[model samples]
Target: MTRAAVALIYRRTDNSGTQLLFIQRARREGDPWSGDMAFPGGRMQPEDASPRATAERETLEETGLDLGRHGRFRARLSDLITRHHSRWRPMVVTPYLYEWKGPKAVTLNHEVEHLVWVPLDFLAAEENQGRRPWRTPLGTLNMPCCRYQDYCIWGLSYSMVQELLAQGLP
Candidate 1:
């Protein structure tokens, strides 16, 4: 089965609050998740020793944030499997949580359009939880999502976020 990994990079704010980083993938032809908001990650490569390695490597390549050198490993959320009707074949997604201790500078690569640091409280608040329409091969359906500013976090990424929230912050 296909597998992938994502890094849920977070940091503590000045007021002792937490913020999670999210990235908007660059729009590109033939890309299923183009322009979608998601955590920094990608499909696992053969050279990756573990899912954690895939997450760290992808995060660094997409956002230029060296999680391997500057991040502290935290909780590991439950694996999420893509639905059959997803753009691609069903795949196992491993979400790795990390507390970023790196610099403020972020140099995004072509894979990423832009990145945002969303407050954990904002994500946890019930008021921010809502649904958004998603177009699937079957039909357009309203999917549970989190509305953050102009971005809507949904699908597998949303599932991972819910899993993280269910387990509470580390």
Candidate 2:
């Protein structure tokens, strides 16, 4: 089994106190989640000591923002779900939440085409409501959706967002 990690990076904006960083995946041929909005992260490398290290490393690799330069770790969730990517087998995805206090300039890699800073208010609004089809070992399932910008941040990302929101925004 493989393991992965993702950082749900966020900061406070002048207009809105809290804003999330979402990436628009670069359109790649044969990529499963191409062009979808997602958090900054990837599969864990051999050099990674732990899942947290993998999260921090992948965040910097994908977004060019170091998590250590930001505030201390707010929360860490483990063994959320394994959203199988066709190229890769089922991966244990660990989600990390970090509070950032600085400029939001993202240096995207080839895997990312564009980025969006979505406000929490907008995400909690009714406009972002929808439904998503999910496939699991049990069977096919349709879950509620949370749309952000041009993409619907459903699936595991949506579950992580809900967890963060339930814990109260930082």
- Backbone atom clashes (below 3 Å) for every candidate: 0, 0
TM-score per prediction, in order, is 0.93, 0.87
The TM-score of candidate 1 is 0.93
Model 2 segments beyond 4 Å from truth? 87-89, 133-141
Worst 10 residues of 2 by lDDT: 81-90
Question: Of the candidates shown, which would achieve the greatest TM-score relative to the real structure?
Answer: 1
At residue 49, what lDDT does model 2 achieve? Answer: 93
Candidate 2, residue 19: Cα displacement in angstroms equals 0.5
Error of 1 at 128 (Å): 0.9
Predicted structure 2: clash tally: 0
lDDT of 1 by residue, 37-58 (tens): 9999878899999988999999
